[model samples]
Target: MEHREAAFRKLFDLYRHDIYAYGKSILKHDEYAEEIVQDVFLKIWLNREKLDPELSFRSYIFAITRNLAINFLHKAANDARLREEVFYKSQESYNPAENNIDAAYYDRIKQQAIDILSPRRRQIFELSRNRGMSYEEISKELGISVSTVKNQMSAALETIRNFLFAHSDLTLIITFIAFGWL
Candidate 1:
């Protein structure tokens, strides 16, 4: 374990700045580039045992970094499209106050959506979202497994999305999402 940690640390020290630079070049965002760095190193560490030492590690690591960066871009593009379709293009959202729909209304819609969740699911969602707690922190606090916390959080979000879709305006739903109520 110590040997593994030492080697991983050495590889990280060697590649982190290069990875960050390459990622920033592709992503054009500093925070996402930093995320790419952490994700690249994490992937490398998890798959270290499978690495072919005789092969070019530089080529391999860059391949992983590029793929992750592209995937991030793809996901971001999808999120951007959602914002475009649901929020920016909507006249109602553009003048929400004129329409008598504001942050408080969005909060009400969010609360209604959240009310549809089961008790345990609501607790997990609130802990993770409202309290800004990490899954591991919520798990420790609730005396539950981390995976259980993750699963419950996923389900809670899906339930809220469905509820919002069924019961509220798309503008309200998107407004909550745009503001990261989910």
Candidate 2:
């Protein structure tokens, strides 16, 4: 047990930032990167007793981080596309001069899409995507059936797709749609 703890701790110290940077590259958000790194380390620590010392812990951690990063990107991209669709559909009044604030516009759209998700659905989506929790893990954590998790994920994907297709061209929609399929 002591050796396991030590090994996990060493692994955390060695690769935390590299994993974080990889996560940031995928998520493009410092806070989300921090959260994902911490979650990966927590999982490693929790499963340390089962770890094989001879295997490359770095590879294991990198795999976990990469999976988490990809999930976060999918969720974020879906959320972004959904918001853009909603904004266009609503015909919200906007200042023509606001084009100068491109970053603000993007942020607002992201937040709006996130806000549109139900609280539990949003949390589940975020956890599954950003933290790389599998269906079983998420089901256990949330006290829901795996079928429910799958249904929620499908709903999330569908909502994003329907919203995007309503506002964007087929090409842009299809390109973004590929992420969900993948």
Candidate 3:
């Protein structure tokens, strides 16, 4: 174990800066580059036993770093697209007088959508969205696993989205409002 630890430490020291540079060059962001470096090193350490010392560690490590950086960019792009869709839908449905909708009316409809959730799901959704708490924070507060919180939130969002789409004249407007776009 000691020998393995020493070797891993040496490998980390040798490749850490190079990995950071590669990530920064590809990502063009300091924090994201740092995250890539950390993630790559953590993965390497976790899979140290599988590593072949005879092989070129440089190539292996760089390949892992590259793949992780690309995946991160892909997820970031998807998130941006979703945000834009939500914003666009909200703007499209936004007609105060034409739709005969006021803030209080929207609020009531939003509450009704939330009311459709099961009791536990409603609590988790409110804590996460309304209170602006992170899944980790909600998990700690509610004594539930983070995965449970995430699952419950996802279900809650889907349920609310479906209910809003079904009941509202405007398309996905309630979804945008429930998600805090309005």
Candidate 4:
């Protein structure tokens, strides 16, 4: 166990910076790049027993880093698209009163969805949306890495979106706008 731990530590030390650089180049975001580094290393450690010393360790690690970074970007892009769709829908002239629900009812539903979030996630969400703080700003204020803030915010948005979809008659766009995700 000690030997494996030492090997993993050495591997991390050797490749962490290189992986971070690769992720940064691809993502163009420092926080996400840092996350790729951590996630890649965690994956490597978990799968250490499968490590083949005969193969180029650098290549193997870089492949993992690249794949994870790509996945991260894909998810971010999809989330952005969903938000845009919701925003566009919210801007339409449809009247909520036609559906027999007032704006305040939507507000209450939004609050209920928010109330369902874990404490840290709710804080992160509020910082990003309500406080109008950037991910980097929230990270610095909360004394956490930017990646952590981004992850929490992403999770909070998804949770709220799901909650609104399942529990309310409002369209996705209306729910998103009412929840201030736009």
Candidate 5:
């Protein structure tokens, strides 16, 4: 137990900042970035007994961070969707008012926009945004070039934006919701 604790401490001391910085780069927001970093460490600490001492600790930690970030994003997306569904359901059940009809309309348009993308572009985009896979990771997993991943993602974003007239608020909200912004 003592040795295990010491090893964890040493690993944390060595790589916490690197993990945080890597998360910040991918997340592009300070709060979520910090949360991802902290969550990685917490997970590591909680599951320390299962970790292999002979394995590459840094790689293991980074993989954990990636998966945690993706999961956080997924949960956030599902929550947004649930909120939209419940909002509409509650309105229909109780008020029968149409105050926020635009929200629903925009949601549909966003879904339609996604559906209109090329299959490959759409797949790549969804994997990146929905699954929160980094371009390098996605490329490695999909056996595609990083440039190809970037191009497809960019195209997907452009297609979505064109469908929305580039309205910053809608674009941002749609992207966040689609990418599982919490």
Candidate 6:
């Protein structure tokens, strides 16, 4: 127990600053950035049993921080005042050097996950997510029922979640939910 506590503290110390900077980069608020730091560490501690030392801890923690920040942005997206503030700030370019994260790596992973889907399923997923088409719009365009589109989307998300589980941490799964898929 003592050793575990020490390890946790060490992890926190190593990550807190980078997490704070990244959170602030996305959230555009100091208070929320600080909250992200606390939240990230709390999640790490809570899920300590799932830690895989063989994986890169830096990437894992940053993924958690990113998901938490996105969750905040989604909340802000609902507020008239904060929506612009958070969304605009989130568009600012992220410097991977500052956080020691490889943004390109994650991008490839996302594309790879999408690439794994069947041609039709991938088209439905992209039309809904990338093109921001409504189910009715896609159904009309593709001559398919909305129910089919909904099912394909759900399956695509599950496939993405499964790929992330195999290749990364739980962050991307949370990302699907945090992106308002819920």
Candidate 2: regions farther than 4 A off: 1-6, 77-181
Off by over 4 Å in 4: 1-101, 170-182
Ranking under TM-score, best-scoring first?
6, 1, 4, 5, 3, 2
- Across residues 1-182, which tens digit of lDDT does each residue of candidate 5 receive? 89978987887788888888776544445676688878888898898778887998888988787666556544544687644543343234343364376558666766777898998988888788778899999899889999999988878876775554333232334345565432
How many steric overlaps are in each model, in order? Answer: 0, 0, 0, 0, 0, 0
Give the per-residue lDDT of model 6 (tens digit) for 51-112: 99899999998889877865675576567676655544554565657443545566777888
Write out the backbone clash pairs for model 2. Answer: none
Off by over 4 Å in 1: 1-86, 92-101
Backbone-clash count (model 5): 0
lDDT of each: 0.74, 0.65, 0.74, 0.73, 0.68, 0.76
Ranked candidates, highest lDDT first: 6, 1, 3, 4, 5, 2
TM-score of 4: 0.44
TM-score of each: 0.50, 0.43, 0.44, 0.44, 0.44, 0.56
Looking at model 5, residue 19 earns an lDDT score of 86
Model 3, 51: alpha-carbon shift in Å?
43
Q: How far in Å is the alpha carbon of 167 misplaced in model 6?
A: 23
Q: Which prediction has the highest lDDT against the true structure?
A: 6
| Candidate 1 Cα deviation (angstroms), residue 57 | 49
Best by TM-score: 6
Tens-digit per-residue lDDT, 35-79, candidate 4 = 899999889888877888899989898878766854654454458
lDDT of 6: 0.76
User: Candidate 3 lDDT, tens digit per residue, 35-112?
Assistant: 999999899988887999799989999889867865664454448664455345436546767555566666787899
Clashing pairs in 4: none
